[model samples]
Target: MTTYSTGGEAVVEALKTHGLTTVFGLPGVQNDWLYNAFYDARDRFRVIHTRHEQGAGYMALGHTLATGKPSVCNVVPGPGALNAGAALATAYGLNAKMLFLTGQIPQKMIGREMGTLHEVPDQPGTLRSLTKHYDRITHPAEAGAKIAAAVRAMNTGRPRPAALEVPMDVLQQRAPIPAQAPVSEPEEEPVDAEGIDRAVSVLAGARRPMIFVANGAQDVPEEVTRLAELLQAPVVGYRTGRGIVDSRHPLSCFLPEARPLWDETDVIIALGASARSALQGWGKGGRSLIRIDVDNTVHGRYGQPEVAITGRLESHLPLFIAELEKKGIRGEDLAEVMPAIHADWKERSSVLDQQIRYLAVIREALGEDGIFVDELTQIGFASRILLPVHRPRTFLSTGYMGTLGYGFPTALGAKVAKPDTRVLSVTGDGGFMFAATELATAVQHGIGLVTVLFNNSQYGNVQQMQRDLYGGKVIATDLQNPDFERFVTSFGAHYGRASSPEELAPRLEEAFESGLPAVVEVVVGDMISVDRFR
Candidate 1:
């Protein structure tokens, strides 16, 4: 710990209370006081420096998601926070829990005539818009209570995220330490028996049912599987819940297929999910939506439920299963609906399999220890179609906030976070290029990640629409290749491009075997063409 001062001690104490092991971000003058605080507490805490603030925020996010616990990030204000805004937005968008810490210029000099040095007008105000909870420490004396409020907020009603900002001067002052722990994490309400019965009644009554989950509920696949078995509902994750269960599971009907689903379905239950519009199926007047989530913010108006139960997913689900069994809602038979859905999906899967054999070959060659990272484009759908994600934590994707450029940085973080695993970034050409510059960060940092850039060249999703609706005329759907493999070589990361499935498989094999940073570019054509195109 390179820190000092009573305020600094307060921050350290707060982190210790939270059991935070690592802090990701570079030390800067603005954050000097906080760094000094860390220096002082170095024996109990450790800091992991990142090259970019975005990377640091993302690294902390990856750590939080992987470990299922909150992670800490220390960033300087201005560009540091701005650069990290995307990751913060992602955290909010994903319902991920984290603490974003930033050091401020002295509070007295906040908005003065001399331009406040590195201060950018409204610092905490700017952050407050994106975060669920954020506040600045006005005085050293208020540190304990403020930090406790932030921590308590993280455990309460709806945990988007919390931010605690301390000014340089504020961090240097001596403050009274609280004797007792500030805030305790809130406990979930036990799954109510009445609520369970109500949920099952709705499910049992529905002729056509669909379960759209948003979070990675698959961590307890058996429980989820049990529920699905009881209802015989077609299970699918709108976006975040993509790989909750094996997409290839015979019982589940949804994948990242392009065509519309849930159209014929009359009932939808959203559990531990952020019930977005896309998944809800707009204008479906008759479809009833049943939601169960720990976060109360998911429901509108107030923390009320619409045929819902509120609590942690892990704890509540088993009880739900027990209740369903107790009520004698034994088995469901959607035999007719199941066959048609299966046939429609199978037809599409067969067509897709013919084209993307490369993804499977690559997975096989990389072996069981391989780790897969997915981007938002067809890379996500394609991987779902081509690869078999057999185990948990072996695969990671932005299920909540599916964004581009998330792949490379997240892969690097995952690699560094779990060095023993073989990490692979499966992303579209456009998405891959978003953080392509980070290849230098990867190589320079000496982290080895195998990047499989799905080179459809243009924004694959947009091109597919144009190809289907228009006459396949290449409008904005074209790219000037920069010899990606060689282009990234300057960054000390190896590259290999493949135009065919045969070519991609061998290249991925060699790259994974090398135990170094490498890129394998695969031209899979417009995979969406498979989605919309006959």
Candidate 2:
């Protein structure tokens, strides 16, 4: 049976087939047909209208991160596409699966440069640089297949963002609507026997073996935990690696405590994580490294690994854990060592009275199940070590991209995805202003998001850099912030202020309990600077 449909209708059907029930986008003239298609099927699809294209992209990313599924973000051609670049790049850096759909000029006038509205000389090429895969729909009939291909690319192997562009005329044209079905991800590659043997041998021989888990291994929490328990290895998580293991576990250690152990440990098992700067080039010199990753290109990029297992952690970790048990290798429990390490960190962290106090309040306020979205702030950098995350995907950040202005929008998306769960966006004064307009989006949708704005009136990170490196000669870092109370209230949301550390907890508690979109601004002075984890 054949059915006639416009390219826009085909896209809507494809999204439904892909199990996408919600999408984030802003309707515009160039993409009116697609919006019309969505309007016709509004009962079946929930479209979140964002204030900006960047917000739409971040919302898609937040939804995907929370649910472990891909979502769509639709934007007009050229400028809107460019505006979405930051969130798309952040998604790429975080290895998130997102489908970015954009409107393109009519196929007939695509490259003629006849001043068509919303035209870019090479739109697809620009998007190619930002996404894992890029495709353009030239005809209405191709929409379903191209969308399927994009979804496949998003789900297979190491997931990343993918983009598709549809021309205006093509979206309006009628063609046969192909039947679509759910796209299945490719099977995880079988664990290599030789690599497993090599890894097991190293673990068995080493007296002190440490496990370094990264965000890539987030899916295999059980396997990761079992492997750690079998070896009794101290596990260090960085970036997305947080909450892979319970922070309160006896063997769980953060980067600060694990840094010294890097020198003492005879063998290091690097799982689904890179030996990046955050690890301080751990695998470089004297340490023996056994690395397991889905991307083989990372092998030997930082340092040569004794065994490079090229397979998903979910597939290879269980095999390695079983082999370790077969060889009668068991790790010594670090029950005593872990407590002392945690105590020392606590004492040192206490020295930064204001920062630690603020973090403690927020941590207590959010409780165990609450989600924390961090932007690039002094508090954000500190929270990576101080905050305790207990579940996968609970802590969302810009990751390696270190993108500012990511917290609020991403938190909005997370709230949309997990409406029942408490979600908070923690940002600095400078970063908060970037996406502050999102308050309208939240209030309009009745998303009761609590934003904790740490207002120091400066780009604290860069200001500290100049002060330390250039003898206190600060340049363009100071900021004049708006009256947050008035700003948020204007959106019909509540607002509160805390000038000192003692006031934060109560204000945060009140704001969160209000069940409205709110901002709690904390005014910390220049004395609150970034402190290194010693």
Candidate 3:
């Protein structure tokens, strides 16, 4: 069935076919026709208009990170696209599934550099650099195919962002909709038998094995847990990889807690984890490495693994477990010794007393199912090792990108994805100001995101670095912030204040109880830095 429709209508249809009903975007003249189409189909779609392009991009990223499903982000040309570049780059680093849509100058005006509206020297080049797949829809007839191709690019292969650029003229033009079926996400690759055999041979003989997991292993928590139990190996995750195996599990360990064990381990199973710092920084200590991942390029990228299996862990782990079962091979369970290790770790990490105390309050308030978004703040730094994440995707970080100011907006998107679950963003005074305007977006959309703003009135991390490393000379680190209560209340959002962890707990409880977009400000003085642990 073919029907005449505008390019914008075709693009929206392509997105709807993929079951993407929500769009995080900021409309402009270049995307006027697209917004018009969105308005026409208002009942079928929910457009979360943002105050800035970066907010739109990060929110889309948050949605995907929380749900492990692709989301859409639409922006205007040139500056709009450039503003969202950081989020796109972060998405690329984190392997997020995001489809980026942007408008171009008039098709005829492109490449001529006629000083036209929203023109840049080479916009397509920018998009190509940030995304794994990018294309331009030259005509109205190409809109559907281009959008569909972008979706396929994101869903298949190494799960990165994809982009498409459409000219305003093309968006306004009408053409017959092509008869095309919706693209299905490709299946995870089958296991490599030879690779699996080599891995099993190494694992069956090893007395002490360890498992390291990252974002790639997030979906196969049960499989990873089973494999870890079979080997009686401790599973360790850092940052974005947290909660793959519940922190409460005896076999589960945080990055810092696994450091001492790394010395005793003879074999390591790097499951969908880069283990870059462990292999490169910590030195392997002659451990036999076995890596299982979907991206084959990681085989020798960090260090040459003794055995490398390229496939999804969900497909490869069961085979390893079955092979170990056949051999009747099982390592000593660490449950008996884990309690002592946990106590020692707690005593050793007391240097971070303030951070741990604050985090405890937050953890209690957030509960088990809530999502916690981390920022590049001092507390956020400690959280990588100090926080106990009980479920997958419950802790969202910027991965290796270490992006600042992504927490609040990303938390909004997480709340949008799981409205019934509590979502909290932990940010510093300096970082929260970046996307603070998104408070309006939350209030207007009724997002119900609760933000915990740690107000030290300075970029605490940078100041500490400057004082310790640069001989007590600090510049451009001190921040003069507004009265947070007034600032938040002015936007018609709820606000609470706390000066200590004891006070923060009740404040957070009240904020959550309100069931509205709220900001809880925590006032603190200078505290110890956690850089040594990192």
Candidate 4:
């Protein structure tokens, strides 16, 4: 049956049909009709009005990461779309599932060069560069199908960001609404038999094997743990792959101490992990390698692999474990070696007393279920090894993008998605300022989040780099921060300050338990260089 409906109503109906319950965005002139439709349907949808387009987009990204469900971000044309681009890039880098809904100039004015409000030379092209797919709704009738297609793109193989642009005229125009078919996602392909056999044979012959799990392998945490146990190999997770195996497991190793084991291992199993700089190009070669990933292009990009298995980790891991068990291959117990590794790490931490102590406090406060949103900072990198993440998706970072202002907004998104779970965002003073305005959004929405701002009164990362590389000359690295306590209190939120390491734990505990948006500013010294580790 066909029914008369405005393009705005069609878009709203499409989103609702596709199971979009929450949307984050700001209102603007070009997108007024769409916003009206959302407002009319307010009872059915929860709209979170953010202070900026960037925060809205990031909140959408954070929501997806915490719930493993696709999220939506709506924005106006031109400037609004541009403002949201940063968060879109972050989502793309992390391979997160997000749908960006943008308003465009009327169809007639699209390429007229008539100086329309919020007009860009080629808006679709601009959005295409940031998302996996970009499409336009030329007519009101096409809104449902196009929105469905965008949602499908976000949910399909190797999930990524997608955008849909609707012209202002089309949104306001009336057209007959057609009944739309339900969105159906394509099934993932099964693991190849030959690839599975090769992986089994390689593992069967290996003596000292190591499994490196990446974010791509997040879905198969139990299988990864089983495989690690069966192979008796040390398991190491990098980036998004952090909690693939319980970090507390005796065989589960931290990245800092796992380097020595990498040198001794005869075979390496790289699962859903990219060979980024952090892994030092997958470490000095010469080891038998088995690489598993859904993306085929990632294979042999860094290190030559003996076998490349292309499929979802959830599907391939169980098969690999079954084959290994059939062959009677079991991993050696490393109960004795774990303690020595811990001792070495403790000795190394003696020089970073304050940083270590602050991290210890955060770890104790967050416990196992708390979500930690990390920004690029000295302490951020340190927590990768010092903190123990027992569950998947509990630790969120900017991934390969290394975005600085991402922590606070992303934490807000996570809290919105998982309200029952406690969320904390740890950021450097310089990075926190990028999204500091989000404090209002947090307080307004009652999104209780604990932000631990490490204030060294400078851009510590670059400051240290300049000292090491440029004759100890520091340029453009110093920062003058506000009184953090008063600043947070002005927004009707709780605030705490820790001038020294001893005050960190109690202050953080108080702020986190305050049941409001809070900030804990911990005064710290300049970052120590990696040369200290050597």
Would you estimate the TM-scores of all the predictions? Answer: 0.84, 0.96, 0.98, 0.96
Best by TM-score: 3
How are the candidates ranked when ordered by TM-score, highest leading? 3, 2, 4, 1
Model 2 Cα shift for residue 109 (angstroms): 1.6
- lDDT string for model 1 (185-259, tens) is 575666666777787787666766667665536457677777877877777654456556655565564444422
Q: Which one wins by lDDT: 3 or 4?
A: 3
Per-residue lDDT of 107 in model 4: 89
TM-score of 2: 0.96
Candidate whose lDDT is highest: 3
Off by over 4 Å in 4: 278-284, 530-534
Q: What is the C-alpha RMSD of each candidate to the true structure, in Å?
A: 4.1, 1.6, 1.1, 1.9
Better of 1 and 2 by lDDT: 2
Instruction: Residues 60-169, candidate 2: write the lDDT tens digits.
Output: 88888877788889999989999998999999998888899999888889899999998888888888998889999888778878898998898777788999999888
Write one digit per residue (lDDT tens) for candidate 3, span 459-508: 99999889999999999999999999999999899999999999999999
lDDT ranking from best candidate downward: 3, 4, 2, 1
**lDDT measured at residue 492 in model 1 versus the true structure, 0 to 100:** 76
Query: Model 1 compared with the native: what TM-score?
Result: 0.84
Residue 511 error for model 4, in Å?
1.9
Clashing pairs in 3: none
